[model samples]
Target: MSATFAGPITRSPHPASSASDRIHRLDIRDLDELSPDTTESHGEEGLTMRNQKEIRETSIRSARKLNIRELRALLGRCGMSVSDYDIEYVAALHGADGQPAYGASPHDGCGRPLPGNRGRPLILLSDLALADLETAVVTIYHEIAHHRSYRSVGHAGTEAAAERYGWRMYSEFVRQSA
Candidate 1:
């Protein structure tokens, strides 16, 4: 089946701000700090995939318990901003009339430009309590990338862009964290 990454709802630029200015800004310094050093070893030499997965799962569980500020900091280090948005952790996402789904970005519903901050875009996350830390983290970045791509390229190319950008950023996060 084809995978669809949801895009963000577009909003009109505020009188005092332009669309370019509102686009999510990636912090280079944060990224720099998150980059893994090639000289360092994360003890991957003898671990099997299952062992590595267990370690990652443990890390994710610990991360979920982190406070909002800490969570934001982690995301920030991955070059994502949760500053202007409200994040909702849900059991699972449902389509219109509540159909089962994995995740979605509410802003991606239409191409119409919304009023400046008209509504809090739902960064809908599903099964956070059960998802692997890597999956949860990457999903968040993936959604934010959708917002960024929607702003930059509009709806037509959002999914592809989000996938490209999200995976790249997530990879960097994993490397640096490792």
Candidate 2:
């Protein structure tokens, strides 16, 4: 398959402030830092993926293989109205080339929301949790479930909400993939 990388998402900076229903949580962790290279080595040569940078770059290329439209459509299928900006931001954070340092905690695998940042809507995604298409859809839908919760209630009831809607999100993703 042909793969084209989109440089980086930080090329266009986001506004400092936005509505509660349209903000994105920036997860600065580098998914590229982790190595998943399994390329076979040649005889007597301890040659491997070589450097972590190469491994990370390869990972970024692999993640970029997902179609953006398909990702948006996947979210739409689950009833979440996400903007192109949100998708790009999520993709950037999950992809390579975005600034590293900021990360989503608790939900470190994906992205995280700002603490005490009430009335702010955020979607954080991470390759750690959603490494492939199936998990990607699952993770995005899970965040959307949270968005739905926020829409219904000014703020969501953490424990009950997660438990109630978590599996539904996972199932919906599996269904869509199937």
Candidate 3:
């Protein structure tokens, strides 16, 4: 049960423009900003966990944890292939060190298509969403919408688009249980 604070994610001069799938999307993770001093136990599995700056906090708690592999499969069912993006479980989403203006809302979750990387885009999901499968699914949909729109919230019709896309997916997968 040890907790530590860290820094922020630095953006390179230019984001990667690969040919593969053009990785890009939002990744919602658990809540780390809410629990900064909280401690978690990993026993002997060596599972690392935390929620702070410029760092990615990983957790082994599967209570409702969303599996990345499963996430891709779910996306397939949703009529999208996010193979171009990389999704990871995180406690909080951080902005570029000194670039708060370009930072994202540490709320539900966030998706980024350009973070200066060579591989697929990065999606920072809230690890807290792991507490519920439906929440995770819906969150994915929301972020997927952002990816599809190629823009995070704050733009015109961006948030609406994410909501529509996200709920549609949720209804298709959860409500309908398809």
Give candidate 3 regions above 4 Å deviation.
1-64, 74-81, 94-112, 115-118, 151-157, 175-177
Query: What lDDT score belongs to each candidate, Candidate 1 first?
Result: 0.42, 0.34, 0.40
Candidate 1 lDDT over 62-178, as tens digits, reads 333323346668777755557665566566454432334434555423432222243654456665422555555555655665454445444323333334444555566665465
Assess every candidate by TM-score. Answer: 0.49, 0.37, 0.44
Write the candidate numbers in order of decreasing TM-score: 1, 3, 2
> Model 1 reaches what TM-score against the true structure?
0.49
lDDT of model 1, residue 92? 48
Model 2, stretches more than 4 Å misplaced?
1-68, 75-85, 90-122
lDDT of 3 by residue, 76-124 (tens): 6655556665666665442223211111212112223533143554555
In terms of TM-score, which candidate is stronger, 2 or 3?
Answer: 3
> Which lDDT value does model 3 have at 149?
42
Reference-based lDDT, residue 53, model 2:
15
Q: Cα miss at 171, model 3 (Å)? A: 1.3
